[model samples]
Target: MEPTPTKETVELTTESGTLRRRGEWVVPRLLRIRSQAGAVRLDMSQARIAHPVVDIELSVLSGSIVLVLPDGATADLDRLHSPHASHRSRVPAVPTHQAPHFVLSGETYTGALRVRYARGHRRR
Candidate 1:
């Protein structure tokens, strides 16, 4: 029998200032953000997706939050509930009507939340 896949969780609990993660990395199943008066920025332009589904939960009271994904990544924001927050993206996200999906949830009290997609580079 095949083993069931377990979800991985990455948490960020900062009081002030900014937290940044960049370069080629692997994405976890769940990303939890809880900033009291700080900012968090994750650049996943060269990240590797091990699973088909990933979830990001943001809970920022103040400051700002940003998430950068690859060009072909798909995002599902139906569970996101941020009344006073803003989500910005220049290019259109690939529809999450298929297998692989990235779901974003949770809420922000008085911070700016943005999700953008950057085009990946081709190696020679």
Candidate 2:
């Protein structure tokens, strides 16, 4: 008999300074981030993701958050609530068939959220 694999949920929290997650890391099914006056940079370009869809929940109080996704991966920021923040994205909002999808939902006050593909990777 084969055993079923369990999905993982990762959480990152910071009060100040910078939080960066890059290089080759295992991506979870759900990623939650909370920051206060801190900068966050998540580069999932060389990550190992086992799920088809990943959810990211963020809460920022006065800082910036940057996300660098892998090629062919799409991000959906329609559920994010950033009334006093700026958002910039170079990736597609809708995911392609069988492609990895990231759904972002969170609130930011006086901060910014930027999403883009890895360097040299164009939107498909």
Candidate 3:
């Protein structure tokens, strides 16, 4: 008999201030962040990812959101709608073989979403 794969999701919500996740944290398959203001930072440089592919759903009314990925990791933000915000990415849009991939969706109003490689790490 084959075992079924369970879905894991981690959610962070706040009305203001900063929400950060760094160090040696365990990242789930799905991550959701909701904020009415302030900043949201996720440093996945040294974290343990549960899956090869990760889905992130973000909702921010103001402020900024930054995602620092490990080297060779890629992020896809095509499903994100940010009419009054800006989206910047230093990572590749396409996924690399055997590399971690992140898919971002949801909306950001009057804020910014920045995706980049970790410090001292260059794109491969």
Which pairs of residues collide in model 2? none
Tens digits of per-residue lDDT for model 1 on 71-91?
556676667777777776543
Report the poorest 10 consecutive residues by lDDT, candidate 2: 1-10
Q: Which prediction has the highest TM-score against the true structure?
A: 3
Mark the 10 consecutive residues where model 3 has the least summed lDDT: 1-10
Per-candidate TM-scores read 0.78, 0.91, 0.91
Total clashes in model 3, counting residue pairs 3 or more apart in sequence or in different chains: 0
lDDT of 3: 0.89
Residues 1-124, candidate 3: write the lDDT tens digits. 5433545988899889899999878888999899999899999998887688999998889999999998888999999988899999999999988679999999998888899988788544
| Inter-residue clash pairs, candidate 1 | none
The per-prediction tally of clashing pairs is 0, 0, 0
Global lDDT scores for all candidate models: 0.73, 0.89, 0.89
lDDT value for candidate 2?
0.89
